[model samples]
Target: MLLVFFLMVAKSVHRIGPTEVGLVTKRFGRKLPDDNPIAFNREAGHQADLLMPGMRMKWWPIFTVTKFPWVQIQAGEIGVVISQVGRSLPIGAKSARYRTEFGTFTDLRGFISGGGEKGVQRPVLPPGSLVPIHPVGFLVITARHVHGLPVAPEFAALARGGKLVAQSFKLDPKQLEVAVIAPHGTTDVIGLVTTLEGEPLPSGDLASRIGAFDDIVALETDRAVTDAQVIDILMGTKNGLHNNYQDFQAFLDAGGRIGLQHDPLLYGAYLLNPFLVRVELVPMLVVNQGQVAVIKSFVGLPTLDTSGEEFKFGSIVAPGHRGIWQEPLRTGKYAINPRIYAAELVPTFILTLNWANAASQAHDLDARLEPIVGKSREGFIFTIDLQVQIHVPDARAPKVISMVGTMKNLVNEVLQSAVGNHFRNTLQALEAVKFIETREQVQQSAHTAVTRYLAGYEIETKGVYIQDVVFPDELVAVLTRREIANQERATYKEQQAAQTARIEMEKARGTADMQAELAAAQVSVDINGNRAQAREAQAGGDAAYTRITGQAEADRVQAIGLAEAKATEALGVARAAGFAAQREAIGEMPTALVAVAGAVAEGKINVVPDILVTGNGSSLDGLAATLMRKLSPAQDGQPG
Candidate 1:
């Protein structure tokens, strides 16, 4: 029965929390039967099963229950009674009774209340005498103290010499060193010595067995717990300064830790944040209008009409404002450094104009006045008659506002300088005719001078003309006298020229008449000569024709005469022969003879021979003679 009870109680044990475990033992070395008796089962063979918080087991009268504590434990009930052994208490035993409160058991070491102080000596036991004692009674042995009796050297040596206790100490701002405890064995056997005032354990003493008597023992400090409060302070302060208060509080709540180096109060004060104006200008030029006009002055001014004013330094002058004085106005106020700022002149002269006319008028006046003032060898005032035509190429209006002032001064200077001594002398010499030629010469000079002056400035000189001329009072008188004398001389020369022209005209007319007469005479001579030649030619032709005709007529007449002469000779010879023949034929018949003779006389005899040799020739000859005589005598009576 006893063995059964022990087994049941021994099995009715369990552990709580991580650092502790429970062990159960049996009474009288006996084991009981278990519900599940596997070899690995820790609760095998026992009616006292492993007891959890609410688990219950059958408790038999024959079995004894016992518990072996394997680690440290805390009793949870308040005001529970706890018995201390091997610990000395106060003289009043009842008043010195020990009690537990708030789940913690308080030590009664050094609890005496009387005037006579009693010291309790530490009891030294032989090895293994306090083995297997319950921790609740053994752990309270730290309450004992020693007094009165002189300590024996051997016992003192043994008490002081047993195991050495090590301690660590530190001071807070209050100069109180906090004690740290390190334990290696049973709490009842160990001792700690320290110098911290009012500390519960200046010298640590152990009330419970730790290990074997021969084994060296030591205390291990709970560093995490020992430094926890200080680490919390540092972490909290550091968080507050670093703006990490929330994180620091979380760390404390979660049992997180830090070291001394994380303190926030040790930081230094200096810290840096760092920053940059841009300038620009417009380009332009200015020109004068005189003999010195060839030189241009540079004016650094804005080309546009800008509301914002620009300042200039150095040699530049302010356009609208008074020039900066070299001296300061007051002690703290300085005249603006001449090298620092300047006022800008807005460029108003972009419009183009014809300035040539202005210069011409000035030149004419200068010429006329020079002689009148007896200053012909000096400079004179010239009028500048300008023909200004403003041309605005861009949308901007022509900037004529500044031009009026500029032109006035420019004209004055130019006229004064340009009408020099040489110009004056020339004007004086031609004083009488100065007015007449002044416009022409002035126009010429002005065009030349003004063009050169404005060349660099790029201003266009469209044209120039001499509009009018004016002479000084003195010059007018001198010029008028000179003019009268000039008019008289001009009149005399005109009359001489007229006479010379008339004489020349008459000479030319006479010459022309002489030439005409000479031509006529020559023509008459030619005509007469030609007539004579024609007459001679006609006479020669007529003579030749007459000679030829006379020769031809003479030849014709000679030929006819020769032919008639031969015919006449032949007729005479034939007639004589016929007459002879007829006389012979008509022999001795008076009538027939007469008839034949008449026929022969009329030249009609047909057969008459000159020698009539007929048969009766001789006889008939005589008869014919007689008949012819008779016939002749009869014809003589009628016609023979």
Candidate 2:
């Protein structure tokens, strides 16, 4: 019993090891301030000064010493300091203001002299930090351990029950570690920063830019701001000033606002203070080939229209102004803060919009479009499957977006109405057959109309095509029947031609089969023709001979008649003259009697002997005597 008493007395001389901290408490002293749990003037409660690693002698009855492990932060972890004994925190302030002289809150006298308030400290203990924090004045909470003494009744109760954790102060264990915003395999990400401890954001601002767009105002005042200069001004950030919010006091000193930050944390690890800043991982903006990102800034200078007076749809401004930027981000990845800026991707290539059942795989602007349905002039309904190709020039993409708001809106609103209504009205005034036959003309007209319409929105109409035409069922049936009838008629005509050809072929075949007999008959006919020609020549020769003989006889007879007539004429002339002379000589009757006597003397006077009997009577005896004389002559001739 005496040895135990001696050992208890020897406990007055405390020996603190190299890895331990000695927290001193005054057994008898003046009362500490009501607001301060620690005594800086050597007054009551727990003393502010911590005993370092060494032998420290405190009288056993007057002082008490409690050994504690030094505050230790492991790798990939941070220690958040919460002050329990300092000046009361100012109203509306959630954390104590930090000072450079505080020196990580390791110097108790300096921290108290520097006017450190009592609450959570703004600065955090970074990974691998080792310090001897005052046990009663502050509490250090780490990911896996709590390293300071709990002086408050509730904290002491929770700590005794092993329930005093990093979460008890509303700090997430994950947040205590370093923030990583780097590529993981195929996923590239960025950290969007939101500061919890700073001055409130400016009025009418959704986010807080580093310089509050002062640079933007300067650029806007200058009329000769180039795109590269604008881009450089917009890319400037204040992250370097605060060491990525690892130094929260530096962030506050640099005029960081309490809201979403304008700039996002890029590809790196950050030691962000959980009490002051929170980070959300989001996908980095990727503008691919054939595409452009049109930035609409929600945080920048007051909008000043860069688009000319001719543009009335919306304000188009330079890159850093608070409106749709005229210049676009083309084909690259950007770590843009989504909360501060909205990026609308506009394809710079030709975009095909289909007013049909099909949707383009490259874009979804045409997904909601259907075939154009209209009625023809004859009340025939028709469905037209149309496709329109448009291009948004890279330079004009922002203007296009400003006018239409989005590519989908360009399809769904302006182009849809223009194309569909034009076709409907065109079909309403055109006959179905005429429309089908003049599809090319109609497509060309649609191209012209759409070109004219989209030109107003700064969109280039590449082409407009009528992909297919679907006629009404009744019209289709009628056309099919007509086509079938026409085809049948053509088939019948072809069959008739085939039959005529077959008949000709049969005639040729028969002619070929009877070739020898036909040749013999042709030879016989030729022989008969030759014989008939010879007979005709013989008949011609005989006719010629007979004609010559008749001609000669007629010529001879005519010559003889002409000579005899001439001789008779001469004899008559002589007689008439002789008579005339006789008449003159004797009387008219004596002339005639003389002519008769002369005629009798010329005939040998036979007229007187035979005529004497004939003139007297019937002359039967004379006739008998003449007949007897003739008979006697005949008898004489017969006898000779």
Candidate 3:
């Protein structure tokens, strides 16, 4: 009865938080048959099953309970799980997909039974929401950010296949970021990948594409030494999606081809798995200004039938593929894989091809080429300075590159050889001395002839400049002597002409002196005769003036008398007409006088009156007073 009571008291109870989980362990439990107590078992030591929140029962001082916070993951983060206790993982992606025994990390019993791996987990716990878990059951750890792991140097020794050579075969988080290949500068280059994992590269192919060349899987695959390998190769090419190689999982699922790609990477930085792919940076074929690059593909299809045109029967190719392309790459940058095509840069400018010992054009096609020397008809050994300007238009640059390989090749092989042979043969037809005089004609003929020849090679000869025609030493000396003799004869002839001109000039001067003396004598005689004639003419003019003056005076008096008489008669006639008109207007003389007297009376002047009247003054006053009285009555029209 007392032991039973003790047993009831031993049954102690405990509770857990709302979001928390309880990890309980039996102090004493079942043991395996014929063996000591197991450290971890279903009914022993640490129980695989976890206690739920808010409830728990345990024997007093026997069973133990420990509470743990749930796992919380924020946005844009992941929880990389590490199994403290579990089995190993299978080989591929779908191996641990349908889990019953290892039913995720939530259920410790299922996880133990599901055969989960003990190392870094393949699947990651995504962000958002908390995950309640037991501390003893499974250790739930966040990604590298949540927990600060030690960083390994990027210069860590790498394996032969480009994977990082792990220290003593340990799996670390740094191993996850195994390989990366970033482009350095603005130079264009392509990534050549050779995968060491996956299924072996197809036949002769050395690589494959799983996701990106630097994908984790690809890195893992590349890291595969014979012991721990996955796929052979994952290429950086063949993806219509996945934001470059950032989405590693998507790349692998897409099943990209693994090998040397046709298209190349321009200027940019890139992440790469060195173990998954071996990359070699090759320079781009640059087509500079005034030049064109012909692209000739080495791989693909059979030969095209170009026998009738610019190409031979077996050397035919399609444009931009198979063989030499008709359209060339203009002056610009091109990210072409050097392994696939051959480039021949043909200058499209007017190139001056020189064949002279001292020729120094910056665009010298062949610096090692010597000057052109030919034999004259007289067997004189002479050297010719030849400069031919040639141009290959944009339309024909491709044909030029294909036919003769390059501009340098054309200058060395076609232009130099043909021009040398033609000049050598034509030059022998003329003497060395005659070369200077006939140089213009020779240049024209050569230009015309070379143009036709180079037309077959698609090069147009613009012009040919004859810089110099150097003769042998002996021939030069002889020509100089002949020129001196010719100058001597010319000098003698000019002196003779000068002497004859001088003699004629002296004779003309003597004749001019004698004529000067005769002109002076004639001038004096003419001066004396003109003075005499002047005096005689003056006297005759004076007499004529006097006689005309007397006649004018007499005529003046007669004219004056006639004018005075006529004026007097006119004055009398005008006075008479005026008086007759006045009488006609008035109708009576006495009435006209009264009208005049009335006007005088309106303007009558008053005389001073004296206290004592003088008789003369009285008379004058009486006359004015009487006249005014009479005129006033008349003006009033009253009869007096």
Clashes (backbone N, CA, C under 3 Å), per candidate, total 40, 0, 21
Residue range 396-441, candidate 3, lDDT tens digits = 7766676777667887888888989888987799877677678888
Best candidate (score: TM-score)? 2
Model 2, 503-604: lDDT tens digits are 999999999999999999899999999999999999899999989998999999889988998998998888778777877899666665565557556874
TM-scores of the models, in the order given: 0.20, 0.74, 0.48
- How does candidate 3 score on lDDT? 0.58
Question: What's the CA RMSD for each of the models?
Answer: 44.8, 10.3, 34.8
Ranking by lDDT, best first?
Answer: 2, 3, 1
lDDT of each: 0.33, 0.83, 0.58
lDDT-superior candidate, 1 or 3: 3
Off by over 4 Å in 1: 1-445, 455-458, 477-489, 507-520, 523-640
lDDT of candidate 3 at residue 599, scale 0 to 100? 48
Instruction: For candidate 1, write residues 268-374 as lDDT tens digits.
Output: 11100000000111111121221111111121122223222432212211221122211111111111111122222222333323223332333332222221122
Worst 10-residue lDDT window for candidate 1 reads 270-279
